[model samples]
Target: MIATRKLRRARVLIAGCGDVGLRCVPLLAHRAAAPRVIALSSQPARAAELRAAGTTPLIGNLDERRSLRRLAGLASTVLHLAPPQKNGDDDSRTRALIAALSAQRRSVARGATSAVARQRAWRGWFRATFKSSMRAGVKMHAKAIKRPSIVPDRVPGTAARPRQIRLIYASTSGVYGDCGGAWIDETRPVRPDNARAKRRVSAERQLRGATQRGLLSASIVRIPGIYAGNRLPLARLQKGTPALAPAEDVYTNHIHADDLAAILVLAIRRARPQRVVHASDDSDLRMGDYFDLVADAFGLPRAPRVSREQAETQLEPMMLSFMRESRRLQNTRLRDEMRYALRYPSIHDFLRDFLRDFRSEANAQFTITSVPVESPAE
Candidate 1:
């Protein structure tokens, strides 16, 4: 109960409070002792939505260093879901945030030192020390006489220890580039092939750099394709885009949206200092096969299959960028080290529930809209 109360008093901040961050709010808020939740939003228009969902939203832009000044010493736990600015190799935003946090830590350190010095220099210091010594002696005497010794949880001044903010950053698995469909773990060296993936690498480096300087403890979660009922490629499938043929197909990974949110919260709470883990599920389907499965579930026609050579012409460059990689990620660290059991262990399991809810909602909407209006008191 005491632990729960302590957690309730904690402040957690979510940067880039989009779909995933919003989903995480209830998981923390509905606990026996709810913690304070704050979300960062670049758009002021979203403040009302954030507040409605029980999170206090702070408007700030990552690109503008001046805007991030307000985030100093704001929360003890931070989920950094914001992406790097486009068209840049370096993530200046993350660097700016780290600088702000370092400044806050230094300020707190100075204050703590001053407080200790003032206490030692006080006119009543000797008297207070004598009283404290006497009280300890009396407690020891009482324990020696009639009770087993019990150690105190913490010393008094220790309670005023400087706060340490922990950060959990969301990165992309594309940093691995093409792995020839081989099974790779977090230990594998990153070899990003494109600028988009390179940007993620830059962000990862920034956080690790901050970790090295004792600015913060951070965890990096490398993610693959993220899908939910609403986030799926249903529209692309409907557009009749061509996927690679089975013989030429590339393997891909995925994580359900809710599972990703759960992983983020888990990382925030349980991540080791400077740890990196993959946020991928157990599904090991080829890219084309995965699309076919979803299309079948939705009763839509499957995407047309073409050889890689043919697909180059039919598919957009952005879509082709995804197909160029074929790597299976090993998530042993996520399971063994962090001990996070995936709620949606596979894409199939997620699709089943997602399709069920989607159909039900569609049916309800159709029923409401299609109902005929009757004449009033005819």
Candidate 2:
């Protein structure tokens, strides 16, 4: 029974346990008093993979509310990396997740109420017994319980309670829309211009609302372009995809995959309630120049440059959408607030190391699968 209780009291739960969520598993698993890591996966096939990564696989889909019911009281720390459904402006997935986690509130309230009621009854009995002793001409001295029936379980610096689970949300920087290559901070209000970014905005709003209502203690990490040793633009470079000309190119931010995983772990320790952070590196590179950097590092030919109007015709609408949005993100909170030291502080740092390994074929097992843009939240 003790073992069963320990297993049920898993402390960390990861939703959308894909590449990034999988990356977070070991970081939590190898701690001093390591917490049991539970990862939610829609795919049954990935259960073995999740277990191999030192996490307990919980088969649950964010889209299906019934499957998520068991999530109540299952974890105190939640890493919500699951994304919105591909089709709508609203994030139904996050809504379902919130509903499932919020289910804990009623049961916890009932428990607290029962405890308070018992304490009150015990106090009344003690006071009456003392009065009877005094009337019987016998001296008795017993101290009254202090501060009973009013215990506070609030989170530090916020009104959130222990009944509410703590969560870290992986949000996208694209929620800011087209910034005209301007330098922006977390303080900048979001003005999403497309359906994809609009969904992200809706998710953020829902999380913030949940926090306000004391359902969960949420921290939003507004991530920019994420690159790794294997997640480079090698395919796009090899495919000869046209990049925008220097005059038309826009600024983009980046963070290495390893660095991002570390940041997510740190947020659990250092992030405040309802805080927003940008998980971006320090480099400021234009879209064309970034492609050129990858091409040059990999010893590949640079693709031809095209005007924005020409790109409209040449590139797909998805690619064009990424091309339209441009902003330089400042990760001040990620540094000062989270106190995180990035492994790859800039893309150049990762590229320099990666190029050496590629030239030597140090890890011949390394493979690159094509993904179009630098994945932010999704």
Best by TM-score: 2
Task: List candidate 1 stretches off by more than 4 Å.
Answer: 1-8, 109-161, 359-362, 365-378
Q: Judge candidate 2 against the unseen true structure and give its global Cα lDDT, from 0 to 1.
A: 0.84
Model 1 scores a C-alpha lDDT of: 0.77
Q: In the order shown, what is each candidate's alpha-carbon RMSD?
A: 10.0, 5.2
Where does candidate 2 clash, by residue pair? none
Error of 1 at 191 (Å): 0.9
Query: How would you encode candidate 1's per-residue C-alpha lDDT over 1-378 as one tens digit per residue?
Result: 978776558788888888788888988887665778999889999999999999998998888878888888778888888877767678777777777666777664543434454343332444555567687874333233332133232233433445677999988888888999999999999998887778888988988988887678899998888776666667777788888999889888888778888888888777788888999899888988888997898788999999999989887776788888889989999899889999899978987876677677755431111100010000
TM-score per prediction, in order, is 0.81, 0.86
Cα lDDT of model 2 by residue, 1-378, tens digit? 979877755489999988888888888877776788999999999999999998899999887899999998788899999888988899999999999987877555443434464455456657877899899998877864344445444312222334458899999999999999999999999999888889999999999999987788999998888888778788888889999999998888888888888899889879998999999888989988988988888789997999999999999888888899889999888889888888988878888887777678755775665565645655
In model 1, the worst 10-residue window by lDDT is: 369-378
Error of 1 at 185 (Å): 0.7
